[model samples]
Target: MGDGDRRLTVNGSLRSVPANPPRSLLDVLRYDLGLTGTKYGCGEGRCGACTVLLDGVPVNACQIPVDEVGDRSITTVEGLASRGELNAVQQAFAELGAFQCGFCTPGMIVRATALLRDDPSPSETEIRAALNGNLCRCCGYPRIVRAVERASEIGRSGGGRP
Candidate 1:
């Protein structure tokens, strides 16, 4: 590897790429690695559109550099599903029509995934706090909250195979 190059694991695969001085992990994932589920909403990390799981914690991809990722496991929205089946949170989101524009769905889903893993039965307030960063212009908070609640139930019921 070159001096400015780093290798990182993303979505169960190891990939090595140049560590661009100014480019963020969002650029690396979308441009270098072809993973575009993590969107670019504000580019300032406030919108949560670029959210991704780095070592199971949610972080804004646009605020992180490729070299900084190191060996941590990165989970994007693309990694949420297994065997072409949507995860519990995703299924709940769809079933509840939690998204209208769908621009914030990926980040919301990613953040919710971590939330459920930490607290399978989070209260609505807890769910709101977890998804505070992700913004949906369509004003879908009520349904989104319901979706997360549903996902928690699904998790306990062994349904949706999430």
Candidate 2:
């Protein structure tokens, strides 16, 4: 690593953080690395729209400093797919039309991905509780919950994996 350059693992690939890196991981992921799938909603940790997997845990990228990231692995929404196929959660969301405006879909999917990875069969209440921090203005919570349930089924069937 150079004076102002940092290195980290992103989407299973080793990458170099931009020189004079931006303050927040969100900015670096979007502007510096062109990983724009992580949305910028509230610019605060309150909104989970900037959620991403940092070391396999969902975090509000807007609140994580670039320096604090160090060499941790970061996975954006774009990283959920494999072999040109969407992951279980993403496919379930798409098949069920869980999103309305689509602005919060990426964050929701990223968070859901982590949830399913940790617990493949989360109950409806557990799903809601897990997604409490991620707000959807279009009132798509019903579809979102159903999609997660469907994703659990898919995951169990080995049709899709998170």
lDDT tens string, model 1, 1-162? 788778889989888888666679999999988898889899998899889999999999999977678789999999989989999999999989889889999999999999999998899999999999899988889999999999999999988644
Give the C-alpha miss distance for residue 133 in model 1, angstroms: 1.2
- Return the top candidate by TM-score: 2
Against the true structure, candidate 1 reaches a TM-score of: 0.93
Residue-level lDDT for 143 in candidate 1: 94
Global CA lDDT computed for model 2: 0.90
lDDT, candidates in the order shown: 0.90, 0.90
lDDT of 2 by residue, 69-115 (tens): 87788999998898799999999998999998998899999999999
**Once model 2 is optimally superposed onto the true structure by TM-score, how far is the C-alpha of residue 47 displaced, in angstroms?**
1.4
Model 2: what TM-score? 0.95
Error of 1 at 130 (Å): 0.9
